[model samples]
Target chain A: MAKELLKGNVAMAEAAVRAGCEAYFGYPITPQTELLEHMAARMPELGRAFVQAESEVAAINMVYGAACTGKRVMTTSSSPGVSLMMEGISYIAGTEVPMVLIDVMRGGPGLGNIAPAQGDYTQMVHGGGHGDYKTIVLAPASVQEAIDLTALAFDLADKYRAIVVVLADGSLGQMMEPAELPEMQPLKKQLPDWAITGEPGRDRRLLTSIYLQPEDEETTNIRLQRRWMEIEANEVRYQEYFLDDAEIVLVGFGTAGRVALSAIRHARAEGIKVGLFRPVSLSPFPAEALRLVARKAKAMLVVEMNAGQMLNDVRLVTQGACPVDFYGRMGGVVPLPDEILSEIMRLARFTPHDLNGHTRAAWLDRLEVVRGAK
Target chain B: MVATDIQNAKLVYERPESLADVATHYCPGCTHGTAHRLVAEVLDEMGIREHSIGVASVGCSVFSYNYFDMDFVQAAHGRAPAMATGVKRVFPDRTVFTYQGDGDLASIGMAEIMHAAARGENITVIFINNAIYGMTGGQMAPTTLPGMKTTSSPRGRDVETQGYPIRMSEILATLDGVSYVVRRSLHNPAEIRKSKKAIRYAFETQQRGLGFSMVELLSSCPTNWGMTPLDSLTFIEDKMVPAFPLGDYKVIDAVKSMKWKEG
Candidate 1:
């Protein structure tokens, strides 16, 4: 298909449709409303199911319902709305219903403003809902990535029989870019054997998350853990940029990762060895990849539009092989490329010679100064 | 002698084919089993049992899926209507219905049920209003009458403090999207028969492509009500009916002119 200038939200919505989403249920929340609006206008014309649910809670449950029929279903929301959907999402996870969810995230902690932020990194990666379950969390950094990832989300959801989340920030949701839309895939006409699609030529089917017995619930939890482990083994995704000869690395994802790429290019032009390690899947987080990068780099700077959420994961993977630093701007503040470039420059100054001299203590004192200022 | 007489007698009360042969988990004298039987009979009579999809709501009827011999999806508390809406919208040719409780429909799920009705979703809703939350032990439900003492309302449901009981059928009937809305009791055989007819009419409305149809049956939660099954039947007739009148709240012209057909 020809490339079209599309907003990220609209592109993702169209991509989901092309990916053969059979049903969409969502309420209007800023940053992500356009996706819901696009689906509203297009789904009915395509003869698919669409509902402007009364609330985010209702929308997710509707997706849960449609998913039970073994159909490709999805719902989208922003921060607070996603919080409202946690209960339904947990239920979908517990029942092992395959569906896609798009979280075009805005600022959080409350009814925060609708500006771009990577505040939901922990929530998405660590399972926001109640219970020990995991969702396939895909962080898309651009309009094109959003479109591609939203389509891939459905396939992954079905493959794992689990919820797949496309976690993008407000800027990615609102920005316009040229995207080559994928060709439409035909919808599946026959329901899967596990689907609850009326009982003719089959035994009666029931789909639920409830397990009254403790042992039964434990068995289900174990099965879910095994599936998650399998996903972790096979579905870890990341993008490496200019890492072949680099000594310093910039780690980020989503909008921040995109921003860090510009910083890395700027740093490279200045003769500073900085590369970018962008995680595409935040849940099965590219820990192994980061471990490899950590061994090659002298220092790593984790950039985010939140107060160092993904930094914790980066630190764990790096395991002190190299010093990992964090630069974040929270509450809807998008980190500037120059700011990240400066952080990269600061990391570059921590050479082996400087580590053995007063320059090391000076850098430590400067870090203390920075922390005190915050 | 009785066995010899039985061999010569006709069996008039065999279980409905649409009903699964599993033993119910309902408390003795609870009307959920009766309501389930009515829905199963209606589905069988219409011959839509094979194509019917039931969304079982979270409450006592959460396990209702196991008792019905059709594809069933169990929804989280009060989400049955929203779930049913999805199913019906996706498979418009198939029959879809939600079985919900008073707490599930009138309390936490109030928005889902109301919007589904207001949107005119082509589905049937079987609401059992037993004036208490049965599944979670006797707590005050949205339909709990004033001065009714339960676990949560130990001092009796103070009308000033706890608010008035919700008459869901009457409330839902006011919505323009509803094609049929009725409140029936299941306290006696005569009332049970009427309730079944109403259930049939509700399903027929859905089958005829009419808008939202719901039959709110005044059921008895004997264990939760702290009454024997026989006394609970009397409670529905004497106490519940006066508060929630037994009558058709709305019957749109399309539903009134409709005739039930064998699929």
Candidate 2:
């Protein structure tokens, strides 16, 4: 296949079509509108359905309905729109529907801003919807990665009988990079037997979330919890950069991880043995992967677009194995490599405090309002 | 006891293989059973039971999924119409319909139901209007008559405070995409027969690829109304019928082609 420059969002749409997704339903939101626009142009040509729904709520239900028929389906939105879809997402998860949701995240507590942010990390990984269901959250860093992971998302969604979220951000959504478009994988020979297309002289099929009995709820929750544990055990993914001989390591994801990789290269140029731990799976948090990096490094710097949201997860997995410091730039600003390198130097020289010791009341108070809205 | 049991026997009910054999969970003498029977009979008569998909909403009628033999998907309160739109759009050849209550369709799902009608989604909706939230223990519904008393309105619904009841069929008939809109009641045997015809019209319209079809059946909730089953039917005939008149509000079948427009 010939390689070409493609924005991450467009690449994702192409990959979704190639993956045999027959429907794309979404409401336009910033940084991710290109994805829906691409599908609107391409899906019709592919003999598929493309709908710009009246709202995110409607868009997700469209996905739910199409998925109920066992058709390959998807929808894309940004942060605030994704928030509006959480109720539907939870329903989809509870019902065990196979569909893909792409969140090109933006800064938010409210309509925070239409810029990149990693603020949705906890929401994505810790079951952004509700119930004990888990969505396999794939974090893509580049246009090619976005394309590849979107293809992977469908496979994972169908295989696991779960919703799969492709967690990218505005920069990755907008940035163009050279991507080698893979040949479309042939559609699966069969869909899940539970999907309800029509009766067709067979027993009627139902795709629903309601289980009226209390014991049914208990059984489903237990089954979902075990499935999540299995995913955590098997699907952890990460990229190790210069951790062979290093005293300090940087941990980040999505575009922030790419920025951190550049920062690590810069720090190495100055003989600062700072490595990078870039995660490909935002959910399942790559716990063991971070543990391995923490064991080899003296301290870790966690960089993100939100006020240290992923920091809590990192600390939970690492368990104070090494001091973890956070450098966050919220409300659409991505921290520059120069700024991150300076933070690396400060971590190397100054005795690092626990990440919690540095909370600014101004930001914390603002986050309080965001929390209430949720 | 024998006389009471005999009196409770329903003469209007038909034994349909497509419907569950169990007694309905609806309160005795409740018109929901009558409305459901009408809808079920229509599905069976059209021989579309094999191709039908029903979406159940939040109310006493939410258990509609359990009664229909067709594939059923229970949706969030008031969102069944939107969900049904998605289902119908995905499987355009299939018969998709929503069974919703006044609270679900006229109140919380107002935007969803209205937009689906406006989009002319080829799906039928069987709306059961009991004028109160039956499942939630008789709270006031959007269609509850202005002076009707409910758990939420102990002193009777205040017209000055809460305004008037919403007439959904009247509101829906104004939309150009709506192919058929009818309001029927299940209080009497004659009304029951008319309700079945209304439901049949809705299904037939969708089969013809006409736009949205709706049959709003003015139903009775004996438990919620704090009345016996027989009294509930009387209440529907006396109280509800006067407020929500029985008649076809709109019927525009686009599939009937015009010879002058065609070659």
Quality class of the docking in candidate 1, CAPRI style = medium
lDDT of 1 at B224: 88
lDDT of each: 0.89, 0.83
Error of 1 at A148 (Å): 1.2
Best by lDDT: 1
Give DockQ per model, in order. 0.75, 0.51
Please identify model 1 stretches exceeding 4 Å from their true place.
A351-374, B1-9, B261-263
Per residue, candidate 2 scores C-alpha lDDT tens digits across A256-321 of 889988888988999988888888988777888788778767888788888888878888888888
Put down candidate 2 lDDT per residue, B4-90, tens digits, no spaces. Answer: 988998776557756877777887777777777778877787788889888888888878877877788878777787778777777
The local lDDT score (0 to 100) that residue A67 gets in candidate 2 is: 79
Relative to the true structure, candidate 2 reaches a TM of 0.93
Give the TM-score of chain B in candidate 2: 0.90
Off by over 4 Å in 2: A351-374, B1-14, B253-263
Itemize residue pairs with steric clashes in candidate 2. none
